[model samples]
Target: MSLFKKFPFKDKPSTAAITCIHILDEKKTILYVSHDADDGCWQFLCGKEHNIEDSRVVSLQQIYEIDKSIKKIANLEYGKCAYRKYKNSKWNVQ
Candidate 1:
């Protein structure tokens, strides 16, 4: 028997998971959010919609619980950042 018969995924993923990012200001106000599917290459706050079997809320709540009260800014926030995502299925794709 072929292992393909026992596994759901074939050689590659059949769907692509989509996510959005929202950035907040000093007053916890959302300044920018992802508007399109290919809106990358910017100082963005990341967020993802999880599929948990619970409440009827489709879109997962994103609360950036960070202690932004400290006024700590010398020259920059960080050094390098790599933008990547995990493997998962799409929203409405089988």
Candidate 2:
């Protein structure tokens, strides 16, 4: 039997996971993560949406949650895929 068959997998609709990196004039970058809400998980400013524009909106929301003073420097789309797992811990980008 294939190893893939050993574990149950459910096919679900995929959503685009948007991430934004805020650049500062001081040559410092800010990556936002909700420590209180996310339980100390480190991640970039991110959200889920169906399209690039919608994803940008979601990313804006995420950014505001961290700091309203931070303006958007740029936006980039990483396409759509399942959440990457980190061993038995929290999810991470692959």
Candidate 3:
């Protein structure tokens, strides 16, 4: 099988990931993104479930579009909307 055939987001048995969600109304959404203590750029939603309800699966499954590989796309879109709003100081420019 081709290397690309592997699921991008599948965590290996040794690697632990926590997944979360980011809900956006206008822009600058509530990103359930995480960061390591040292480097902060590689942020991602926590990807593991501790329990049924006490988990972020609800949010993850609700994302509109995009695949897990570029999950951050949604977050970035929200951030862009937020920036536009903040820059213009309004959700609608009128």
Clashing pairs in 3: 17-47, 18-46, 18-47, 18-48, 19-46, 19-47
The sequence of per-residue lDDT tens digits that candidate 2 reaches over residues 8-49 is 212111222234432222222333333222322223342322
Candidate 1 Cα deviation (angstroms), residue 81: 22
Ranking by TM-score: 3, 2, 1
What is the TM-score of candidate 2? 0.18
Deviating ranges (above 4 Å) for candidate 3: 4-14, 20-30, 38-53, 56-66, 69-94
Candidate 1: C-alpha lDDT: 0.24
lDDT of each: 0.24, 0.29, 0.31
The predicted structure with the larger TM-score, 1 or 3, is 3
Native-to-model Cα distance after best TM-score fit, residue 74 in candidate 1, in Å: 35
In model 1, residue pairs whose N, Cα or C atoms come closer than 3 Å (at least 3 residues apart or on different chains), thus clashing, are none
Candidate 1 per-residue lDDT over residues 4-83, each given as its tens digit: 34323221222222233222233323222221224321222333332432112112122222212111111112332223
Q: Clash number for model 2?
A: 0
lDDT of 1 at 90: 17
- Misplaced by over 4 Å in model 2 are 1-17, 20-58, 72-94
Q: Estimated TM-score per prediction?
A: 0.16, 0.18, 0.23
